[model samples]
Target chain A: MVPVDYYIILSAVLFTIGALGVLIRRNPLIIFMSIELMLNAANLAFVAFSRMYDSFNGQIFVFFVIAVAAAEVAVGLALIVEIFKTKKNINIDEMNSLKG
Target chain B: MTQTDFYTILPLTVLAVWACLLLLADLFIPKDRKGITAFLSALGLAVTLGLTITQVGRENLGFNNMVVVDGFSTFINIILLASSLFGVALAYGYIKRMGLERGEYYTLMLFSVTGMMLMAQAADLIIVFLALELLSIPLYVLAAFARPNLQSEEAGVKYFLLGAFSTGFVVYGTALIYGATGTTSLGGIFFAASNGTPGLLLTIGAALLLVGFGFKVAAVPFHMWTPDVYQGSPTAVTAFMSSGAKIAGFAALLRVFASAFPSISVDITAVIWVLAALTMIVGNITAISQTNIKRMLAYSSIAHAGYILMAFVPYGNKEVMPVSVAAGLFYLVSYAVTNFGAWAVVISLEKAEGKGLEISDFAGLAKKYPALAIAMTVFMLSFIGFPPTLGLVGKFYLFRAVIAGGYTGLALIGVVTSLVSAYYYLRVVINMYMREGDPTIEREQWLDFTTVTTAVATVALSFVPQWLFFMASTAALRLF
Candidate 1:
């Protein structure tokens, strides 16, 4: 049988990579995918911990995280598309109209 | 699931159901008569507020103890409901004038308020996570409500990205807590912590939770999106978002930390102390250089977030927690009122196409319209914590609480930041009353009403803060 420690280690690695992607990526779509990757990483950790603890609460929480991520995607993608409509490009650096 | 459970969430259920019904009713309302939708939204808030009033002086646990309806929840809910009413009033004329009138504005606002009320009552980590999204998703839409306007759209996307990023931290933190404590409920986690849960795991989880909520409340290092979002969104939406989101964020922080993690208070308090100090310093110093009024107010909101963070410095100290929490609540009241009043004035002078928003726009405002200028001056004074305003009394109570907790050095930092803040706040007052330029002032009735009423409240409430503080004292948090 596989140990829970391995699951936690894998999820932690995925979470770190996802965080780095969000910081380094310039495209809003890619940044958003990184966010989703981060959420899924946490979801993996939650499932592993739920099994380790022999409880359903962590699994239930993973479902909530999934649902919220979906909602965020709808809003975030609409925002990105709207930005694209005006600028013809959605580079993060170009969103400087209201900058200080 | 039971009578007690339903009773605990009666106010929330009523508001949520009313919001859904209002969304349906708005379909038949004529396009030009969107004002009816706004009126209906305020009516729902009033109904919920009435129910919330009756819930005071009584306490109950709901949903198998996932949420508690108690004095603290009642106190915060009243503030959220009242702010929503004010939100509807301010948005009524502003949206129509901006050509952004839509029925969904009010419904989304109502949905956001429901989430805020839930934040105040949350007794479990799951509820906290759910409530954060419920409140934020609508705001992301509302921030971008000005569709074709690139600035507003940018604000929407920026807010969404940062908000989603913060959610990742929160979820992972919750997973860690669950792993260490084997439960997602705040009370269960506390119980586990006391019974030999792994200390290192629990501390890391708590710190991660702090980082998530810090972003939500606009604390330093997580506050990069605040100014752009505030300066870009519609003025009326900025007015509502500044007050509602900060209040809800702090509510969730107080609820989760005070109830669930007092065991780790010593380790966390030092970090909060540094955060509060840095937020005050950075927010105040940055505000001094802003050329636009909206950006100025945005930084001011961030600085006040620091003052409120002072209340959490001694959250684990049983002797000082209630007093400090009450002080924090009092400061939120003062800040919300002044915020709405200031934003109302900003809304009044704000021209379509984003003209009349700079500090120079306020030049000769007093000469042209003494009444509006004076009202604006009053809000500026309240922001500066000057005499004869609620801001002064709020600061007094806050500093007193901080000093009582033996964090006098932190209290001194707050005082120094307040002094530094006076420069920018007074500049607006001086421009409004003394400088020479003609400013266009819109005279919509609702705009005038909210500005004048909140300004009056800011001054009048200062005279009798004891009664309000007395009420806040009774509205203390309870535990399982």
Candidate 2:
């Protein structure tokens, strides 16, 4: 049988990779994809724990999280597209005109 | 369970229903009739605010203890509803002026408010997370609702990215806490923390949770997105966010920390103390350097968060709980009104071409628009904690509570920084009265109504602050 800590470790690693991508990637779309990966990593942990603890609540929470995540991506990407349409660039650096 | 008990959730339920109706209205309403959406949404919020006031202290556990009704919740509900009404009114004119009037704008705002109300009432961690997303997702869209402005679009993207980043931390922390304790209810967490030594996992979870809440409240180190988002969003939306969103943020902070993790070690309190000190210093100092009025106020908002954090220093201490909670609630109410007042003036000064937000633009404003100059001066003085203003009374109580809690040094720091804050606040006044220029900088005329009313409210409350103080004290007592 697989150890619980192993699953936790793997999920943490994936989540870290996602965070790095968000920090390093210049493209808004890639940053968004990185965020999705981070969220899915969280889901992995949630499902792993649900299975370990034998409770349904954790799984139920995952359902809500997925729904909200989907909503967030849809709206977020739309805004990004709107920005790209005007600026002709999807790079985050090009959006610095709003700085104080 | 009982019929009267069902009425306890009336405010939240009404708001949810209004959100759905607004969504439908958005789909069917013509572009020219978008003003109807704003009016309908405002009416719904007004009714909810009335219901909340009438239902105060009618405690109930609705939807299986997920939503709560109590004095604290009622107080925040009133503040949120007031700000929401102000936003809708301001949006009516601003939206039309910008030619971006859309039914979806009001609908998203109503829905976002529904989420905030839920966040304030959430007793379960799962519910809190869900409510938070509900609050955030709509705001992301609204932040970018001005599709023509590239700044608005950038604001939406930044807000979404950072907001989602924080949520991941919050959820992971919640999951860890659940792993440590057996349940996700705040009561259960409190029982576990107080009864037993908080284990390693719980400690880490608690710290992570603090990070998450800190980001929401825009405390220092987690505050990178605030100035950008506040400056980039439409001025009316900025007012709603600065006031309405902030109240909900603090409500959640108090709920999670004061109620859920109240008995944690002094280490946690120490961490909060450092955050308060830095938030005050950095927010005020950065604000002084900002020439852009919106960015300056955004920093000022962060600094005000520091003052509120002083009220939390005495949390978990038995002798100081009363004064602390009272000071916090009073400060929140005062800050909400004063900040909204300041933003109302800023919005009135804004043109569709995005001019007049610079601090120098207000030069000779007193000559062109005497009433607006006077109102802006009142807001600035109130923000600076001058006497007779609600802000002065609010800060007096907060510092008193901090001193009473034996944090005299921190209180002294707060007072000194407030003195430093007076410089920038006075700068606006100086420009209004002393400098020479034409204040022909114009926008929607309707903004004058909100500006005048907010100024009057601030001035009027400055005189009759006793009632507000008493209400805040009463609300504080109920919380303890």
Candidate 3:
């Protein structure tokens, strides 16, 4: 019987935290995790909103978002592993060989 | 799905099935014979193009109104297929020369093209999100396809990080929109907005959606990832991303805003106006400082996005909506052709390990190869919106539409920024003809053919733009 506003507020806060992690994190691994956090936060909001609207569409979208996140993680992990092989580091700060 | 639903997405179905088949077929193909994959990819695109062509002039909704088959999607699909064909052709030569030939490249590009086609057809928010991911994930892989190349890896990481961030924004926005209106369908949202004043949640949701799409189209403020990503990725991949992503992003933007949020047009138009103006100024002004050809073109592409956004500044006006949208579509087509041609020239001049990409490398191109230089000149002129080029006609339509909507100031800003753009676009020409440095270019027949064809089309179509414009206007009419 939790209020929906509380759920929305919680979701927004979690989303902001995830976005901040993405901005502040330098490790690619952590950045990928942050992106997953952001996606999960959106999923939470989607499910909550679905409950409020009494519609199954939002829940269906969440299922798809989960699938997409898994695909993204697969690609992200592959990229991280590739970069790790060459540079011996996954820190974004040191990854800047390409510049003007 | 019903038979009618299947028919509505026939072209996309064809493309998706072919791309999947090509992905598996690529595994058995030898590396030395990867050209077969590229050739087959182009053939598939051509077949899909023919299929899409047959569906023109029809307007219907299928999949419970989750997908639309209309003039708009058809026109955009035709442009997407043509651009992808050019992408495959350009990649064929560049990849071979760089020793980066792989069947996977063509397969991934076909998948990306399929995503773009689906994006144009999507009528529901969930479909839009799916389409965006479908298009973007493959691009991330392709950007890094030049694995072991440090810069390519960097480009892939940057693009993937920012791209996922933007996708998060889109999903959250969709959630908010569904919460506010209780429906995710564009038509349903329109009915809701028409019935009553929109709530705060709806407005915020729409703004978030803009931020998401703004990143995709590389509009200013959300364009931080573009320069590095475009410059670091392989030139052919950059070319496809710039044109293909921009066309699809704008299609979705126009569809969502013009159709779904018409009632809140006044509020959103102001936001669009500011975004367009800033994108023009920043995209053009920044290009002047870039020495790398790919980086300069990246900024130029961003500035072009600003001009396209001008068409949406009038989206709220029912009277001018169709004209403005049609003008935007025509501009996309012109920009795609001119951009691919320009990149073809760049691909020819570039060497492995990213040497000879500086603007200075273009010096003396005219003396070395007159035909190539002239083709480059045509692309430069078109980018600068000079006469006898499709860029000019596209601009004329855009400005006319905006002026008709009473946004003369926005039109004026567009003109001024284009003038500013001439300084850099023509700088390449000046570097080629006016300066003197020996430039070495690879002898690639496919690249040369694409460059010449696009350059000629840029000029030839300008002289007879009526037919294309007519098609665009008809397409725009269906959105209402």
Candidate 4:
């Protein structure tokens, strides 16, 4: 049987990588993918903890998270497509029309 | 699952159901007559507002206590519904004038507001997460609703990316909390914490949750996206976003921290102090150099978030928690009113293609329209927490609460930042009154009405603030 600590450590590492990808990636699509990675990492932790505790609460939470993530993806892709139409390029950093 | 469950969340259910029906109803509405949609949305808000008002003094736990209908949620719901009503009023003329009128805009607004109502009622972390997204997704769509505008489009994408990233933190935090306690319900977590659920996981989970909410409320260190997003969105949306979104974000903060983590307040209070202080100092100082009015207001909203955050520093002190929480709610009322009033003036001055947004654009306003200039001045004063405005009374209550909690240093930072904030806020006033330039302005009935009404309320309520204070105290969170 796999131990829970190993799963946690793995999830944490994946979360960190996802966070780094979001901060470093210039492409909007890549950033979205990174965000998905983070969500999946959380899902893994939730499932592992749910199993260890023998509770269905954590698994139910994972379902909601998955649904919310799907909704986010739909809206996010639409936004990216809209931006691409106007600017003709999809570099996130190039969005400097409104600056501090 | 029971009828009690439906009764407890009657207001939220009503709004959500109305939004869905309105979404279908909007499909049939003619494109040229989007005003009907706005009116229908406002009617929905009015009905929700009435239902929320009826829920006052009636408390119950529903969905097996996954949701709460209590004094705190009731009060915040009243505020949210009223603000969305104001949001509808402001958006009515502004959208038509901006040539961005569409039934979907109002439908989306109603949907966003439903999410906010849900946020105030959320008792479980799962509901909180879902509510946050519900409120945010519509806004992500609304922010870019100024269709095909490059700046608005960019704003939408930027807001979505940052918003989603922050959401990841929230989900991860919830997972950690669930791992630490084996439950997702806030009440269950409270029981677990009190019974001594010992681990680093819970504390880290709380910290991660703060990071997520901090982004929502636009606290500094996580506030990088605020100015750009606020600047690029439509003025009416910016108006709604600043007040409505902030109220809902703070509601989530109070709900989670006060309920689930009082056992861990010792660790959380210090973190809140630093966040409050940094949010105040950074938000105020950066706002001073802003040339664009929209960007300036964005930073100003950030600074106000700091002031509201100060009331939470001593949340663990039994002697201080009630007063501080009440003060926080009072301050939210003041900020929302002033925010709407200020944005009303901004929308009035804003021209197509985002022209007339600079501070210099305010010059000659006194020359052309004295009443508008006066209303604008009142808003600026309120933002600076000056006398004869509700902002002043709100700050006084906040300072008293923090001092009573024994956090005088945070109070001092709040005072000094308010003083520093005067520099930029006063600049707009000076331009409106003293400088000389003729900036063409749009005259809309709803625009002028909202501006004048909120400005009057901002000043009048200061003199009679005890009523607001009483309401806020009555709305204070009940102890477990």
Model 2, span B398-449: residue lDDT tens: 9999999999989998999999999888998999899998877455655777
In candidate 1, stretches whose alpha carbon ends up further than 4 angstroms from where it belongs are B477-480
Looking at model 1, residue A91 earns an lDDT score of 95
RMSD of 4: 0.9
Q: Which run of 10 residues does model 4 chain B get worst, by summed lDDT?
A: B471-480
Best by DockQ: 4
DockQ of candidate 2 (2 decimals): 0.65
Candidate 3 per-residue lDDT, tens place, B1-480, comes to 888899899998898899899999988988799999999999999999999999988889999989999999999999999999999989998988888898889989988998999999999998999999999999999999888988899899889999999998898888889888989999999999789889889988999999999999999999999999999899999999999999999999999998999888878999999999999999999999999999999999999999999999989899999999999999999999999999999999999899999999999999999899999999999999999999999999999999999999999999999999999999999999999999888887889889989999999999999999999999999999
The positional error of residue B43 in candidate 3, measured at the CA in angstroms, is 1.1
lDDT of 2 by residue, A14-64 (tens): 878888998899887888888787777777777777778788767887898
In model 4 chain A, where is the ten-residue run with the lowest total lDDT?
A91-100
- Error (Å) of candidate 1 at residue A29 is 0.8
Task: Give the candidates in order of DockQ, highest first.
Answer: 4, 1, 3, 2
Task: Report the lDDT of model 2 for residue B76.
Answer: 80
Task: Name the candidate, 1 or 3, with the larger lDDT value.
Answer: 3
Runs in model 2 lying further than 4 Å from the true structure: B1-5, B441-446
Going through the candidates in the order shown, the clash numbers are: 0, 0, 0, 0
Candidate 4 local lDDT, residue B173:
95
Model 2 / residue B413 / CA error / Å: 1.8
Listing candidates in order, what is each one's chain A TM-score? 0.97, 0.95, 0.98, 0.98
Error of 1 at B236 (Å): 0.8
